[model samples]
Target chain A: MPEQTDRTENPEHTLVEVRGFRMAYGATTVIDRLDFEVVRGETFGLLGSNGSGKTTTLRALLGLIVPTAGELTIGGEPYRPGRVRVGYLPEERGLYKREPVLEVMTYFGRLKGMTAGDADRWSRSWLERMGLADKARLALGKLSGGQQQKVQLGVTIMDDPELLILDEPTKGFDPVNQRLLMDIIAEQQRRGTTLVLVSHDMAQVERLADRVLLLKDGVARAYGSVADVRGEFGGKSLNEVFLEVYGTVGLEEDAA
Target chain B: MSAFGIVLRFEVARALRKKAFWIGALALPVIIGVIGLVQFLGAQSAQQAAEEQAKAGFEFVYLDASGVVDARLATELGGAPAADADSAIAQVRSGETEAFFDFPADPSTQPVTIAGRHVGVIDDGRYGAVATTLLAESAKTEIGSPELVAIVAGGVRTDVTTYLPDGSVSTAAQSLPVGILLLALLFLTVVLLGQQVLIVTTEEKENRVAEILLTTTRPNAVIAAKLVALAIAGVVQMLVVFVPVAIGWALFGGGLSIAGLDLSQVVFDPQQILLGVLILLGAAALFIVTLAAVGASAPSAKEAGGFSALSIILPLAPLYAAAIIVTQPSLPIVRVLTYFPFTAGTTSLLRNAFGTLPLVEGLLVAAILFVSAALVLRIAVRAFRRGALEYDRMLGWRDLLGRPAR
Candidate 1:
């Protein structure tokens, strides 16, 4: 295990931290000892190919999965929902498909600790903003795949959570909708929300991430600011750097 | 509202909103009511046909070789005296006589012969019934004492009150049906709610709503809320079913009896009813939590159904051995069932209702059920917490026991 320097050594600026984190299932270690921190008000790109322990890391950090032998904390304490305002967009996108779009959104909002009226109002406003104003009463299953993804994102950010963890938020989106989603994520970042964006799109990560962690085979292959990571890889683009690190096998896995 | 309340309210409201739930809830009562209505209408129609037949009048001739038949009685019953057997046979064969009755020399030992034009199979029973009535009337006239006639009529009813060793009146016969009724009710409720209980946790997993909810609330709280919500929904469903039945009972339950069980004679034992209720509550709680655990452990609702069926079968399994439970309540198998948490509800109810279960033993059974229910509930909650996020595979025993992943 290599010791990695924290960009911001001060605990107050670090909203998310993982120290010597390890996760295993039946002797199969999914994540080996790893270390990183997400500073307040910064977008941290957790970049990895498929099955590279990216989702597992996020799940562990959110306390959804128990860490085998290390510490994972948010806001200086282990994640306890409602203790800190947090939002998550899981890679496997789904909601109550039989339920009305607005109702599904509001149900999640209430679970996130928003008042019913506030949840309803926010959900309606979000539908309008996302150009899904006509879809409020329609069953979520009636929406197209891309539209459902937009609604899923709306649910994730509905409460204006202090921290947003998005896994493949722009997946299955057209270029224009992808741009709109990026803008919304950037807005959240500008509002001082610490964000962890997990994506395969190197350009999106390079444009949004202040610091990035490139993981391969459950180990951190590159860590620190995007510029420092690029420089570490001989000043190549993050895409070229990703190609160099994962090679053709990563591409094959990603395509699968 | 608290997260528990939110989850509970959402689950119950979701159930109430589904058309399938209401249809399922209303199905049993509707089918029962339809059956009852058909029976009632058929009875009325049969009765009306009989009254019309009586109004039209029946003409008959009698040849009494025994001389037991009184002339006045025969006249009152629309019977004419026939001079000889030949004349009576001729009249009946020519269709001039609707019917003819021949009383043998010894009417008590020898059968009365009825020669009549063919009536329908069921209607032919009226002839034999009327003949018996006529004989009884004539005998009453001959005896000249109402008491002797009453004794001869075979209308004696004996109410046997056996004393227990402690001199308490034995009400076992009276309580048998009541106990069976309670057991049946328990079986019915479990069957009605089994599928719903099973799907409560799996629905969240299948719909991918579990992770979102788990991120917001405590897992135990969510599981507990769902169990409570399922109970509430079950109660609601039963109410929908029973309300109409109660209304039906009020409207047309006159002369309604099951297997000759005069329900009116059933003694309402307050202590016994209370004990049965407590046992039921414990069993219901245990069943709900167990099924909920099964739901959480399974990856999908369909898979959970297989396990839920097994859980539903356990409580009702003792019913197959009901004869032993009732006849020999102290038998080892019966005692085991009475103490076992899953089977205890039905066994205890049966024993208590049959007046075979001692008060102390009944109370102990209730206590055992409650204690076991609590233990199972704790285990279920723990398993649910561990398995709630497992969407791709079933949770095995090792996972359920909370052991660290191998």
Candidate 2:
């Protein structure tokens, strides 16, 4: 166990520190000694090509998977395999299809140690904020996909986790819902919650992320502030920068 | 709240919300009730019809080839006596009588033939006595010497000895079948209910809802909640089957009028019932564990079905094998199965019902099953944790059997 540090002293304080992390599934090395940190009160974007290990890295950080080798600490404490104080939204979309919105949210909230009353109150507020108040009592399967994603977000925040790891939180959202999701992320940032956003949408990443890490071939190829990485690639957009580093290699392999 | 508590609460809420759970838990009982009611009505009507047919006097006839007994024997037999032997035989041949008996004229012969109209009649020892009595009486009228009469009476007495043990022995053996039938019912109930638990676990896992649940809660908690919910459902199902049959039996003249009913002995004692429930819980726990492990290991619901079939067949095999094993509890196959967790729960419970299970042996069997259940829960939790974390890799047997070296 370690003490929580004051965020004011270090604005770029490492809320989540991953050093030399490596993970492999039998013969396939998914993450190779990847080093990065999510600063306090900042939204960090994890950018990667299709097999770039973004999801793997997020899963490792959440203590869902024990890394083959590395050290991971959240808020100055080593991650306990089953007791990490974190909230994770897997890239694969899932919810108990038969559960109503309010019940599902409260259930996930309780898992994070929230009292029933508090969980219920906060879940209601979140549902209302996400424009799901009308469908609170409806089973999750009955809600539209985007609406279900909103409930997924609601589940993540109901416990007010110190670290929120969302893997493509805005994958299927319309622009309006996307904006709503971004606003929610922004609100979480305002509350000093450290967020790890994994997305392929470069524009969204550039706008929200304080820092960006580009993973290619199971290794970090670029790591720095969004602007610095952008400038290093000849002042191109983040997507262009991504293309420059990964596009040719992927294309050549595809062609061959 | 503790982590486990949170997981338990969440799982309960999630399971309760599922329409399938409700349908399985609540709706199944209603269906069982309907089925039971139909069967009960059908049985009642059949019984009533049989009773009506029996009351309509069945004509009975017999051939007295011994010739010593005449039409007077028919009068003594306590039915509408025929005018003569010819008429009695004719009635039986015409199907006016339900049955008729014929006695051999030669009473001193061995294996004397006694014939019936519809079937062969083997000597039941009682008929031999009756024939001897009629022959002795006729001989007494023909031979009028006191000394000869005493000699004949002495020989007849020697032939018929009162060696049969009073009544209790026969009564006990007569009630054995009822005990066996109850044991069979218990085994059947356990197998059916236990399978339901397995199917539910596999279905949820296949649908990926279990993954969502595992992510939010501990696997042990999920297993616990499922066991509790499913056990209640199972008990309700048992009641739905047992209660009506019991009420029907009682209402149908309180076990007296029913010729086949045997109530002279205790079929199920309190300890036996408690043990049966305990065994059921152990069986259900084992079911949840194996199914959860299978579900977690499978990549998709479709793949789960293949693995799930093993769980279904394993428990049921022992249940179907119970009848043969109940008779020979110490058989090597039965003994080995009684120690195994899944099979033991159903088989040993039934064995206990039949009084074949010694108290020490029963407790030991129960202990082994409980420990197996705990081990299963542990494995299930590990599988769930690993499965939840590794989303890209389809969960496989390798995850449980061979974890990555580090």
Candidate 3:
């Protein structure tokens, strides 16, 4: 199948673009000649197994790590601090556990340029909506893992960011809350928000992802719409496709 | 608000909310208050004892290897003499003797301390007065009154004046308070604010929140904000302690016959005051950024602690060395400490506050420290960005230097 259109060429509709991006730490190259674009209002899935450079790619784009060589842009501007309203929820649950949930939420909201009153008001509404109105006063450590995940979701969405990158947002949630959060994430994209979804749960991504990129050892193994990749990989389901991709990808890495 | 403002406000808010910060800030003053209370109680007890002593008079039990001073002391003060030093201590412990004056074993080198039973201000005043009279009589009879020795040992009164920077003369008592207050401020700022800088800087890594914070705000902004916030907190805390402590010290300090050498003259020198202020500001800048650099490269709060202790000790070492800096100001080690990054501010602040450091020399050291602070801040920001995620293993000096983490 032809590759899904990369919006980076247009630059107008692209919220994030990376062309010929290369990132290396000493002799170890985490990303080599990687190319991808996250366009405005698109739910783009970045799928890979552990150590497959999905997170590395995200980190490099966010300027957490300096890219060795690349032309990368956020909102058509070089990556400077606070250039756009970008929200990122890392995979490892990175909120301060000792801090109150509302506090972390309000701090992030203000960092995203909301006034104190607006941030507080919006955070309260999000907390109640996430069924965590009672837990707002408590520390994040007091909440169970699933409960903390919900509060983190409130933090990521409290400012109503224009672009979001969520890594496994449904990781510790039960099936009910998982579906609930998935719906909220989908609704966010429906309101003209762009998303870069990084998940190992291919079934979930297949449902929500408009387009998906499958990476193997820092290279794109498959890049197209979910349906197109499905057809290209013998019309298999995403679970079967993930297995087939990783099965061969492992061999490729071993060979390299 | 700017991202810098948000980070700084968050740091200050977090610090203020911490119970540990408040405890650390107020711990010194509470201890001082306890000591002052003890001192007040001691004064009361001594006053009661002094009245009893007037009726009883002084009894000296002594073991004077040198025969001259003790024989003269017994007749002059009319105290019973002891067989040996041990019995005299026993007598005092049992309230039989008022004091035991153990003269120096080597006279020229060893110290002679006066031990007293139920010692009070009256006893102290009488002991000095008596020791002087007997020593004077002995010198006139035995050594023909060495004129210089007689003059100083007689407690000859002086004008006790301090020449001001404004060409006005003031009492030595006034200079003591101002100089001591500044020295105390310098010490607390370095230790307290340095700790705050480490705690705030390392906490982000411990919480693993740097990943999110870095994306939203620059690393430099995050570091700058934490430093500024802690500085504000430090200044506020310093004032909170200063105003009350100074008031108490000033109000109750006069007419108390304390044994220690007077500090009213330590910072009384005109040139030292100006030099000390420069060093104090410079040292503050140096300590903040250097500690931030240490915190950034440390893998966890536990790892950061050793570095914090080092930071605390280096600045404070100069204060501990004040005796050497004051009397022997030209020592090579003292000069080296004044220019060293860690010791510079403290040595300059303390030495100058004690009137040892010259103005031109102290300013040059201050400029070096200021430049070092800026340079270290740049290093810290870079280290923070690179090492934020390498939490599983330690990041050390090499990691801070341009060597990327594997």
Model 1, B1-406: lDDT tens per residue? Answer: 9888888887788778778889888888888889989998999988776655544457888888887788897788788987887888889899998788888989889999988777888677666665666776787888998877777877677878888889899777776666666666677678777888777778777877666777777787788888888888888988897777677767766555676567656676777777777877888888778887788889898987887787888988987998999899888999899898889888888888778888888889888877887777776776666666787898887777775321
Q: What are the clashing pairs of model 2?
A: B59-B97, B66-B105, B206-B301
lDDT of 2 by residue, B109-175 (tens): 7333332244323323333334344445556756778778888777433222222255322222333
Checking candidate 3 for backbone clashes, the offending pairs are B176-B264
Candidate 1, residues A1-256: lDDT per residue as tens digits? 3246775658898999999899888879888878999889999999989988999998888877788888989999999989898998887667888878998898888888999999999999999988999999998989998888788888888888989998887777787778878888878977989999998789889999998998888899888889989998899989998999899666888999
Instruction: Give all candidates' CA lDDT scores.
Output: 0.82, 0.67, 0.76
- CA lDDT, candidate 3, residue A4: 48
- Alpha-carbon deviation at B348 in model 1, angstroms: 1.1
User: What tens-digit string does per-residue lDDT give for candidate 2 at A1-256?
Assistant: 1112234367346688887789987899998778777787788889987778998787666556678888777776665424555777767767777767788788777776778899899999988877889998998889987888788777766777778888888777788778878788888889888889898888889988988898898888778888888887789989998888887787888999
Error of 3 at B403 (Å): 8.3
Clash number for candidate 1:
2
The 10-residue segment of model 1 chain B with minimum total lDDT is B48-57
**Model 3 C-alpha lDDT per residue in residues A127-231, reported as the tens digit of each score:** 888788998878788998777777777777777788899987777778877877878887897798999999998988998888888877677888888888899
| Candidate 3 DockQ vs. native | 0.51
Total backbone collisions for each predicted model: 2, 3, 1
Better of 1 and 3 by TM-score: 1
TM-score for predicted model 3 compared with the true structure: 0.80
> Which order, best to worst by DockQ?
3, 1, 2
Name the runs in model 2 displaced over 4 angstroms. A1-12, A80-85, A250-256, B13-217, B232-259, B262-278, B299-302, B389-395, B404-406
